[model samples]
Target: MSLLLSPFDMAGTPLTNRVVMAPMTRARALDDIPDDHTVLYYRQRASAGLIISEGIPISREGCGYLFNPGLYSDEQALAWRRVTDEVHAKCGRIFAQLWHVGRMSHVSIQPGQAAPVSSVAVVAERSNAYAWVEPGKAGPVQASTPRALSIDEIQRISGDFVSAARRAMDAGFDGIELHGANGYLFEQFINGALNTRDDRYGGSIANRQRFLLDTLDALAATIGAEKVAVRISPFGRLFDMQPYGDEAETWISLAAALSARNLAYVHLSDQLTIGAEAIPQGFASQFRKAFRGTLMAAGGFNRTTAETALAEGELDLIAFGRPFIANPDLVERMRHDWPLAEGDRATFYGVNGAVTRGYTDYPAYQADASL
Candidate 1:
């Protein structure tokens, strides 16, 4: 089989191929349960070796976007079950990326009628922010500031995480991907500028990484590390997170901690960006070497560049986001070296399925060629 078509062991779970579907938030789930449209979406993209579902908040407070699903409720799990069943029927393997936007959320989106929590009170400052922002509408905009979470408060959030992971299993998801990247709560704690606590959870890089280590251990104990993966955009600049400290040191320490637990794999996203050179190649490579499990590199991956990363041993698998959005049969296309259709950027986020309508509607190479 070709590299794109080859099957391999992803942390002991045998996958059918190497191409991975990066998680792209469609926000189409109805009432936090995946609807029929959602079911069709995953089933259509079953050709990939693996699929990381859009971020599902562990608790209501963890959510940042409207209509984004939550793993904390039984209804949500049941809704996901239908979607997962369809994907499995098509011979697809899927994982849910557990999420908690922390400070990135607004009070309207927060749970328990309170402010959004984070490592600090700093809000995002974006000169160029993009995302969906209306009734089924999607686009880009600036970020908002969030409240700081106390140490005691963080412990409660940990319990929420465990509950969410269980919900993922209940939804019949094959595994769970902890959203520890992109200036979310976990990243806020890891990054110095966002973390100012002088107590146990702060002080140094090791101290900052402590929260993640403890959380991962607790989570691994619940579902086992083989079924758990953590994604980190070490050099990522999103969610209004402040940049401080030597970029190299923070990520090296962060990777070592995840590796120590022997996770399924570590996904380094920012390294694959188109023009920006935020996450350093050497930094990501260090984690690839430190981590003995599996290494998946995502963000802006196409055929040539993806293959080059794989050939260099920098990654064991490659995940595509926008490509998957436009090319549901991405693995097949890459296998045969077929050209990919560009996604309709205007519909990336919104209701009435405008974005999702064109989302999985693109025809595969073989199907389109016949036409």
Candidate 2:
């Protein structure tokens, strides 16, 4: 049997298979709260070995997009409990992808119309935030310039992440995955070229990575390290991230740092499918050598490629994103060599007057009678 179809233990969390459902944001949470639609959406894809949920903001200040369900408040936690309960009932393990969008945000979505905060005062040119273009209407707009975060504010934001982690545990999640990838808040700090601060949080390579490491350690202390996972995108040029002198050194050093922590896993996000440069060849193996832990990666992987990757020993687990959108029983289909269905791009983000049309309405694969 292929390793992709086999069961494995990720830290203390046991997964039924090596197939993970990658986090993808579907703007169905109209009120920034998970509702019945959210419950149904997750429940349909409960067959995945692990489901990393779409980014759930730690606080309103951390939000980059409209309609994303958050994990800051107790009220939001209660709403998430419903989704977790349904997924757990189907014997699936889930992790909330806690997020903070930093400069990739607009004042329209900011609290009190405040500017978004990041490691430095800069604007992510050519980036857009899904926010209100006008009153009562939400669409993609150019990201607003952000103010630099004060040291006190940085500490406060770390506290917010810890608070959200506690809420995720209380809501019955199997674990929490820090959304440190794709030029988000964590990446905004880690990228030395972008985070040119004069304080302890910038300058040296160690300083640039200090924010992420510190926050992860705090989360591990609050919850068990075995239940915490983090995702990173190395050489990721998304959201105006540019190449730096120590680009390679930065990521490899982080892999080593994470290795010592004994966390659940280290997930690598390859942005190839999303129209960005892929993680260069041989880098994954280099990372694997540095980080001696369960490793997972998501990009574009079909059944053949996924199986080959597992066979080659580069990735312990393979995460499928868009495939799971149209095929709820993705594991079953792959195992049986069944044909997969394609998803509609237009209906991928928001509900255009039809709430569940593209969200929960995708049907499972049906067998051909003449086959």
Candidate 3:
């Protein structure tokens, strides 16, 4: 029986515990450089067994939002080196989530005045497709339909991801996790509604999942599978509810292919959403049985729910997003059943100043907190 807050073995790396500091993009990396403030923000929460940074763009064309940290440039690499060094000094392991926004980006943000690219041209409901938002703004400027990527372009982007992985390793980080979910570039290729092509990269389940699979192959070859992980959202109408119609088959085949690699871990995005009900009882459990490697879950999981999932053999680790964002010492809080800090919706994203005022300023449990 694995506990949500106990030490566990993942990819042969032992951790202080199973509690992981889930990644949330705070848009804090202004000018693509992590300042002294960035160093303190991460060090404030360096106690998690594992910490994954917000999605870091892998190429210039891959920059989906402004202020989003990147790894493709020399300066960005230098900044990340500082972050990794701090986390390591505290004995904490961290992984960088390499990202590419693809069609989910604005023409103004991409290269050569080019529109955002995708496997198909299908658009989604209200989207967040522009470059990074300024300090205080709601709707982003409308993004144009991206030009479909050619095979040569795809190859180029693949190489970009490979290089980014190398940079992550060079930055003194423990590992890297491919952001293959949440309707991002790799995911756009996985979902059918957005991918209506007849090429080797689109159509059938295997074809739709081709880009991710190939990327995994390249990543495993470039960085040992033991140093690589992948994040996937199996449940949820996320990113415009485009799960390729036959999502189950897609996941089945996708998980099976990844299992073949025996990577570091496979973190599933199946936890409950704000308005969505609990997941059907045994679905994730079944998927865990299906996968032959380390498994984790994220998205709104409380201690009991997480324990149940882990107890049922559905997950080996759990990733808590919003909670960890508000409470840097979440593991300590959870252990003592301490109440959580109610995160301010207003300050969840956007310009955060030096104090990490909204970033790492969440107060720990106080003796008189319970009025």
Candidate 4:
């Protein structure tokens, strides 16, 4: 059996193990630049086989949260360089997760308080975005409806991704991962219910996928194909995403298309949200057969299940999100079968320096910690 501790190679990079720290939104950056605190937070989790950084906005219009980082500015890229250097100092490999939130955003967080942009003019349900709480405070606010993007604007957004990829390379990241899931910008394009455009960006799967694929091709052309990866959620219904009858077929087609790119990997996020339906069994195996490259699966996976999947050749890597938030040495704990600590939910998305509370304060495994 291939234990979770087994070493693996992600494209050209050699991982110390198969454990990956999944990308998570930590509203810590100021003016979209990673501050000194953000560097310390990632440095604490550097023991992971791979660390996928939190979602980074590609441009001012792409931002959805008050303190989330962006890569368009030179100072922002330089700030991220500090984080990459710190993580590398511990011999850790990291990837930047490029993001655009689309309709799941509020005007308060958008550029000049403009309407959030997406494939269609739609409102997200059961969603919230981080916003300013007071003069200097930040908190969650209900998401606002978004305006549809023009064809020219969509092209501009796609081009912005290429620029972000270059900025990520300049920031000293090992690679970059495109965030295509969770009813964000890409899902707004991929999901038929949300993308009701009459032009080439909607109607058919190929058309709906054009925007994402174009961005992918552009980024891959700017940065090497092997250095790019993408994450997708096939059955996810978060942020008011409605499931299409042909959802599985749509994703299968995407997986097949991705196989031709020779990209680093494709991460599959399960529908694990509250009230969300579970994905059908055998979905991972089907995707693996079509993709023909490194495959990663996240959501509700533990050591025993991850080992079984690896042993059975179902997944090449396993990404843990919440576990890594509270356990910086999650790999070491999993290795020793140590009991994990529960994270404080209130501190998960805090602001005003409280972001550092639940972030870097988590202790590594100690012999005295009750198992």
Scored by lDDT, the top model is 2
- Which candidate, 2 or 4, has the higher lDDT? 2
RMSD (Cα, Å) of model 1: 2.7
| lDDT for each residue of candidate 4 in 173-216, tens digit (9 for 90 to 100) | 99999999877999999998778899999999999899988899
lDDT of each: 0.78, 0.93, 0.78, 0.88
Q: Which stretches of candidate 3 lie over 4 Å from their true place?
A: 130-139, 271-281, 352-355, 366-371
TM-score of each: 0.92, 0.99, 0.92, 0.95
Lowest-sum lDDT 10-residue window in model 3? 130-139
Candidate 2: RMSD to truth? 0.8
- Model 3, total clashes: 4
* Reference-based TM-score, model 4: 0.95
Name the regions of candidate 4 deviating beyond 4 angstroms.
Answer: 133-137, 273-275, 368-371
Off by over 4 Å in 1: 127-144, 271-277, 352-356, 366-371
- Candidate 1 has an lDDT of 0.78
- As a whole number from 0 to 100, the lDDT of residue 104 in candidate 3 is 73
Steric clash pairs (candidate 2): none
Top TM-score: which candidate number? 2
Q: Over the stretch 1-371, how does candidate 2's per-residue lDDT look in tens digits?
A: 87899999999799999999999999889999999999999999998999999999999999989999999999999999999999999999999999999999999999999999998989998999999999999899999999999999998999999999999999999999999999999899999899999999998889999888899999999999998999999999999988899999999999999999999998999999998999989898999999999999999999889999999988999999999998988999988999999999999997788889888999988888898
Worst 10 residues of 4 by lDDT: 271-280
